[model samples]
Target: MRSSDFCIAGGGIIGLTLALELHRRGAEVTVVERDIPLKQASQAAAGMLAVRDPDNPPELLPLSELSIDLYPAFLDRIERLSGQRVPFQTTVTYQSVGHSSLRPAINLPTGLIPGDDGLSRLEEHSLDPRQLAPALLTAVRNTSVVILDHTTIESAPPAGCLISTLGPWGAPPAAPRKGQMLAVSVPASFGLDYVVRTEHIYIVPRLQGPRAGQAVIGATVEDAGFSTHTEPASLARLRGLAAAFLPAVADETDFPIVDHWAGLRPYTPDNLPMLGEIEAADPGSTKRFVATGHYRNGILLAPATAHVMAELLTGEVPSVDLCRFAPGRFGKA
Candidate 1:
């Protein structure tokens, strides 16, 4: 029966960021989570801040670009508020090309040359999700945000503006697309300075410090329907992919798979996030809003989503075109 100016369902990264934003604008906010906050997709992400990725839908480019530009300020604000250092870096992302795409005239790491293929370097960055999740939680707790973890919502709450950030398994057009990932320990001799990505896998090196010489290797997309089970076959597949590109990972006898996990990304038919208000469930009822269906970009797109959502909720005009993301576009699907 808790209430506030806004009630957010699904306390993942998107939900926590939205709460932080709305609370900054002087709104009392409550976040409800089915499990501990940041234990789902947000925790499982490799935290790549990428907009120019080939995998990104063209329609999502504008939103992605906007979010990338806001990262600096977002990190600065959160770090100051939370009093925790978020491991982040602005490094190049080397996209490995095979015989199918891009010219093969370029050389890659380990004296690996692409025959009729090459590598494309883009200005990209990454954050350590292990650090980010806790920092975000700290920032939210420092605010007036009320978090009701281990709670589930049967329907929209009876009061306040309800905003749903529930990832997959929540509403229609938003279903679970399971992804499996693993983290491996690399040796100090393993010289991987930038994020490396081929068609199948990505390797993001950890920032220097006590956790230096480690990288996260992932992931496999499966339509297993809300399942987070980790299979050895899938882990082996990811390991093979990692070793194929970064031979150093395999050559280093000490580089062993330290951890593995799976998470569900919220998938939508159009592959675009749903934002804006849900038309009143019944006449004269309080309106609801949604900011889910981000899929794999949830961590990358969080700050921007929170910004625009706060704008919309506070009656301030959002700068971006949200028409395409409206829930009515699905028409009760």
Candidate 2:
């Protein structure tokens, strides 16, 4: 039997980031993943690192702030150690009610304002998940870390500790929320350089050059667990919403379809992610830790989550207070 000081399930962004952190701390780590690192939702994600958006729940603000602060240094460290640039850019994210509605200016603690165009400027940024996930996997591969791809984690083996970083949709069937999305190639003239979010639709610009101009459209949340089917009615509603927000996109193509996909986002009832230790079901075990249920913020929160997990594993003092996010917050301790 193979053995390591730590074993992480789910090779998505969160899992890989945790592995990297543990390895850096001098603990032998092994990652067991079900899919090739970027082929799932991690690759399909638009990679918008928006934290200051007005729509975000207040309880999540601390985690969001921590992630935003950690991103630059996180990217720098990854590049220096892995020798690959993870493309990241800080830009103004916009949220508008309607083209004609008077955009209400929201006062933010960060001092950003709602611009004249009736859109709030969120101190947010984006990264190419397609590029970032693969780069992380490659970096892990180059190190002493072990990666097992194309294998599902049927059960957890007894260990000194176990961390579950599985996202919301990754939980058991009863707790899953399926998210549907699509990617399309647009003309350079579309000129959508910023992330736009409305009540019904969101448009995220791809890091690929302007010529190949790409964006992800249609993110309908449904109760269907892990279903990847693209419903025509939902697609039409999304396109209509997009057209209402950006007339230019509506004028360009009636049917701007490209690639459609879906994935389950592990969602808790309250919409906050579940983190921290799970006392073993058996009284004799040492400790079990979980860092899962991060629905859309998986990419944005990866670094902070990894750091917290490492601190918990090593018995070091944690820099941030994790009491609120404890896995036990979900139910009976």
Indicate which candidate wins on lDDT.
Answer: 1
TM value for model 1? 0.93
Q: Residue-wise lDDT of candidate 2 within 166-195, one digit each (tens)?
A: 565354321666777776666765456777
Which segments of candidate 2 are over 4 A away from where they belong? Answer: 97-118, 152-158, 168-174, 209-212, 252-255
Clashing pairs in 1: 104-116, 104-117
Task: Give the alpha carbon lDDT tens digit for every residue of 1-333 in model 1.
Answer: 656899899899999999999988989898889889999899898889878888778888888888988888888878898998786743878776665556443345552333334778777889887788888999899888888888877543444788889989578989988889888887656566778777678888886544566788888989999789999999888888887766656654678877889999999988899998887759776668999999989989999999999999999998688998898898973
Candidate 1 — which residues are off by over 4 angstroms? Answer: 97-116, 154-158
Measured on C-alpha atoms, candidate 2 has an lDDT of 0.70
Error of 1 at 13 (Å): 0.2
The TM-scores of all predictions, comma-separated, are: 0.93, 0.86
